[model samples]
Target: MGETFTGASDPKTARIMAFGDLFKAASHRMLGFAGLAIALGGLGGLIVMLNAKPEERLLPDPDLTPGAVVDVSLEEMCEPGYAARVRSVDSSERKQAFRMYGLSNVDRRDYELDHLIPLSLGGSNDIKNIWPESRITKPWNAEVKDTLEDVLHREVCAGRERLGNAQWAIRTHWIQAYRMYVGSEPERFVAHSRPGF
Candidate 1:
């Protein structure tokens, strides 16, 4: 259930090859009904893609993680070390997050189990608020999002932005939020956490 003889590298490629194999096997068994099997093979490709739900494309997969937030007031959220005090994602929850994203046999470092709304903005650590953010996904990876989180937290803490609005913006379409709030130059914000924790 891995790579085929043709050496289809990625999982998607491997699955497509597997579909071809299935079509061939069916053709062998059904004799004259090879065309029908080929048709089904095409359909199977769509099914494989549907099964492979990505954690995010441009925005988040709203179905899997729409973001959840705990009841923390402005003062608490703005307080120093607030995110650190509230931040907690145990191993079991992390594993559950992986399963939710249809990921298995993956290196944890390859993905960041990201909080869609982010703890800094009073986002909940509930499983519903989390998703496996691909570290490899360009221009919108976890690190990129972290910048937005930091920016939003600052805005919220400074009374420049509403907590709910900030949360909603990030939760719904962080890419847009990045533009709306963090501005075009997000690289400057990277690796710079708001001190204390």
Candidate 2:
């Protein structure tokens, strides 16, 4: 006999009606709309903020080649003697001069100037010796750290030698060496040692 049609349809019939498919489509559309709305809101906010302020022209980027050192005289400009004198001022004077003038935290609170080579390593306290870094970062020690890591990499099947090659280009070409005057500690920004001065 045929199944009775007393409006007691099988529960499976409800799924077969494809209501789940319709719900999924609606949900996907709603999610897309939500994402678009959020992106538009962020873009609009950025535009408004930018428009509210007058645009200040930025100075041209300085030549960062090592030879550009001609612009700054090492001896006449950044002597440790001058830095020590600057550090001797009264507390209020420092706050007014350094903080008020936006030269905040531009002094070495720890660590002496590291000659790229220690005087023990034939590194003088000359401008080349001076790269302000944390006391923890001994100049030669930084090189040693890299050497040890390289050794580890060699032991580990010379994993990604190209990464090592690319590292030197970025370090020498992109990085700017700063005069090691009594400036702020070198900020190890991300994977780079950039002087915040």
Best by TM-score: 1
Question: Could you tell me the TM-score of candidate 1?
Answer: 0.67
Q: Which residue pairs in model 2 clash with each other?
A: 115-129
Residue lDDT tens for model 1, 68-182: 8887778887899988898999999999888865578878898988898888887888887898887766656778888888877877787765676667667756665665555
**Candidate 2 C-alpha lDDT tens digits along 22-86:** 43354444445544655777757434432321101010011111111112222332333432332
User: All candidates' lDDT scores?
Assistant: 0.65, 0.28
After superposition, the stretches of candidate 2 with alpha carbons farther than 4 Å from their true spots are 1-107, 136-197
Candidate 1 has its poorest 10 consecutive residues by lDDT at: 1-10
RMSD of every candidate to native, in Å, equals: 15.6, 26.9
